[model samples]
Target: MCTLTCIAISLIIAATIYYLRFVRTKPKLDIPSRDRVVVVSGAAGGFGTAICRDLLSRFNARVIGLDISKEVMEKVYSEELKQYGSERLSFIECNICKLEECEKASERIAQILKEWKTDRVFALVNNAGVSNSPKCTERMGIVEYPEDELLDVFGSNLFGHVRMTRLLYPLMKDGQDGHNGAIINVASVAGLLALGFFGFYTSSKFAMVGFTDSLRREMKSLGKKGLRVTCIEPGFSKTAILNLKPQADTEFGRIGVIREKKSAAILRNAQPPKVIGDAICEQIFSSNNLPHLIIDYWYMRLVYLFLYYTGLDL
Candidate 1:
């Protein structure tokens, strides 16, 4: 009876602790975002377009979208220009991977800020990335992967964003100019997990995850009290990331795509990319000082948690 009583009491304490730590809801904050300048890279397709729309329509902020695709830019511009007009929404066509292109893009942004009479940037969303499709070859590991392709992935996913942050650092000012600044990096769940056949993509995201953490620490250490750096990791979503075409029809022949029952079930129920936009909008200005948000399905959390703890091969 004594042992039973102690076990029950311990269970109660553990439950209470868990509830307070992870189950309790944190308060959400809404910063004054109206008319402020927000920059979103990869702002043409996938979650980029949706994030820009949310910032423009919901926050009523002046948004400058940076995208590499001119064709997509023309289409999005035509649609959004009618609603928000040039003062609130615009797009710049520039490849983020190229330093000169990013420089040109920043110059244009400077002109916009000068015209708008705003010297500070409110936010920078580094959401652009690329993935290599698994070719039907015998490349079994990172050693078999082409070195150039690995560099390309890092160029867009990590280094390009780094360049943007460095150039825009002066403009952000981290509330020194009275408006709080933010940097949101959009990474995939693959960043957290080592998914097979995504060596290049996963490596880049892992680097991004580490960079986001270090950047946050750097901001605090530098006494930038108003600067908040965060990273968002999304799970399987119906986005352009899935546009990689495997040459063969069979499940194994397709290289990275697994078509077994469990895997198919996960893919069949992939969430739309727009949810990512809504999630980021909801959390962008929250005062909880959140380091990262794992926007994924319910079971995904369990799967990753299990895999994370047990060192399971599956």
Candidate 2:
């Protein structure tokens, strides 16, 4: 009888803690106009560029745009991003997959900060990823999935973010008061949902998702105060990241068929990358304290819940 009573009490205590931790209501935040600094990788790409623009325009944040291609970023500045000007933006041409390059990039950012006299990186968006897809797993067995490609993909998407964060750790001056820095990792829905013939891409995203989760814990333990790590899982956004062929193509080869199918699915559910960029901006300024952000269309929330409850591998 006493043991049963003790068990009931413990259950009640656990329930109360859970409710307080997750279900407590909080007021919405309206952030003040303050200086914010951000770094965005893959910034030459459509989505990455969009995100950079969103942060700059919406939040008035200083942004460092990093990418392997200098010409694309230059064009972006001359054409689409001309009005934003140089006062709020800087570009670094670097291969994120290379640790040396990322280290150098970090040094450059530090120099910029020292010149400008800033304290920390307000947010770092790991928005870079690649997939040599439309090729099935069997076809890619040796060429793409070989040790080198595997290392390259994982290094760029997963470990590169790790290295960047490590290099910037000392400068993350968030959480001293009500402020905290955020790290957002842009993962795909494909990482959570298993898809056939996407072995390499899926594997790399899963590793990234895992790495972000583990890093979140480590950062918390280190008491980064207001430094928060958020993994962003988004459904398909229409971007060149999908590597779509032009609409004029007539013949459907094996690769074309695969791309056609994937494109159709993505197109149906795709939201503008601006939507995601806006959400990320909100996260940086809003004190909502969300664990992760899922940008999806249609019934994706239900799908995520169902998959999670079913014990499916992430």
Candidate 3:
């Protein structure tokens, strides 16, 4: 009990410092709404939907939402976005994993920009990726993982976003005269700290975190420029990606499968997905955004701190 208390106190102190450094309020983006053009991938998911609507409501800006499946896109998003006319919102059928597909998307988006008479996209939100939804995909140990399964996970989680960034980040670079351009990638806490029973998914997120950081540093060569790369690490949120119904009739005796269920139970206190969406929008439009924006509770942040200082394997 005493040890736990000490840990809690230390965490509280760390969180206080972190809040002061990264969470303090700042001035809103001082740009005209007419100049804002945001492209969001995986826009049909729970958080994706919230991000699209929030951007439209907050800025009345042009939003392009993309999902791989045409059917899912049509089913999840309504044709009529009230208040803001349908003109402010558009949905695209895109598969970011395919290079050719991403190229085609760029051409289409370029046409839209020409129509909007805007020179560039203000931000690109890379929120599409697979998680522990199927359950079976995560049952393997590191060596037990099949080559094909690993590629599929990385294809959606890492390569897809890389493709999107390569093709679309140029738009952000050439954005309006004074506007800041942002590339926000939604990674998971699983990436920040390795968790058991999530081999492929965790590694993919780890790679994403690394990629975002490297990109940020490389872009810094522009010398005090406004273009930024940010990686958002979120814990359990009320999203179908992680909270999907576990498949039934499976053998519960499997060790990894049981462990996965236990992890899900411990994550019963997931915050709503809106918090994440709002955070992304706020960070984008804020005068400055952190290199890493974490969306979990204080204790989770504490764990991250502990790992950082001690270098202890969790």
Candidate 4:
């Protein structure tokens, strides 16, 4: 018993040291100048709003929010415009699933940058996404999942970002106006672990991770060393995606699935949206060539790392 206790204490110390040295270490990269701009999709949502506000308030960055809802965009615009002038905060209505719309939005963003007297886009945050609902609520399992909803999930979660990246890459290229840029893709832990009931959502995130990895390698090989691509895989948070409403009490609710219940429990200790926002900001400003950032509790982080290293699928 004494030996076991000593071993446990040693493991604890080792974990603490690892966390301090690696997990908590800050990047040494310089922050982008005030003249550069950052674009965030789904800017009305919890994570998007937090990131935009952080970049604008902390870094003094010009932030442009893109969302499908004109009303929500107007609301955010009004609130943020009051705190930070139009020069610091702007909004563009974009349905990312549509390639043409993405192209048009890209054009408008280019104009905005030109007007601001800056010819570069510092980063693009692909944060827009939809989550799996109750078993029969349209976006559930793969076998019975509505074909249209499935398509929409793939479109918004994966292809939409693809379209946005394709449209914005020219502006973000290494030599595009002498600016270095980053692409921040918000994936999920579900992307790494195949949750039982969240087949559609998991599948989409998996594809997102794959795409980010491929893009990062391609950029390096193409001599665009100034352009960095990163994937953020966050554990469950208290976001709108949780949808813990009256429906959540039903038998077919999110809790109906053991996997979701476990996720929800972990989210009881989940980090807030601001944590994710701050991490993204750090990634952008840091000099490290980090390809993946996992934001979660210590235990979740350990589990993910162990599973990843062991090639074990959860």
TM-score, predicted candidate 1 vs. hidden true structure: 0.85
For lDDT, candidate 3 versus 4, the one ahead is 4
Best by lDDT: 4
How much is 296 displaced in model 3, in angstroms?
Answer: 1.9
Q: Which pairs clash inside model 3? A: none
lDDT, residue 265, model 3: 58
lDDT per residue (tens digit) for residues 1-314 in model 2:
99667656655664554445334723144554255778898898756877888787777788888898777788876753577666577888888778899899999888877766776677888888776432323333223345666677677768788888888777765545466777888877666765444436767787778888888888788664746777777777777655543322223234445555754764676778887777766666665645656676535544554454454442
Window of ten residues with lowest summed lDDT in model 1: 133-142
Model 1, 1-314: lDDT tens digits are: 99667656655664554345335744266577778788999888888888888888887788889988767876866878887787887778888889999999888888888888878778899999887532323323455656676777788899999999888888777464453578888887788887766557888998999999899888867664647888888888888776654423434335544533336667677888878887776656555536777776655655554455444544
TM-score, each model?
0.85, 0.78, 0.86, 0.84
Error of 1 at 314 (Å): 4.9
Error of model 4, residue 55, in angstroms: 0.4
> Candidate 3 lDDT, tens digit per residue, 212-309?
99888887777556477788988778887664433333343255666766666547878788988988887777656778887867666766666654
RMSD of 1: 4.9
lDDT of 4 at 37: 82
Give me the runs in candidate 2 sitting further than 4 Å from their true place: 1-29, 79-81, 133-144, 174-177, 224-226, 244-263, 311-314
For model 1, name the residue pairs that clash. none
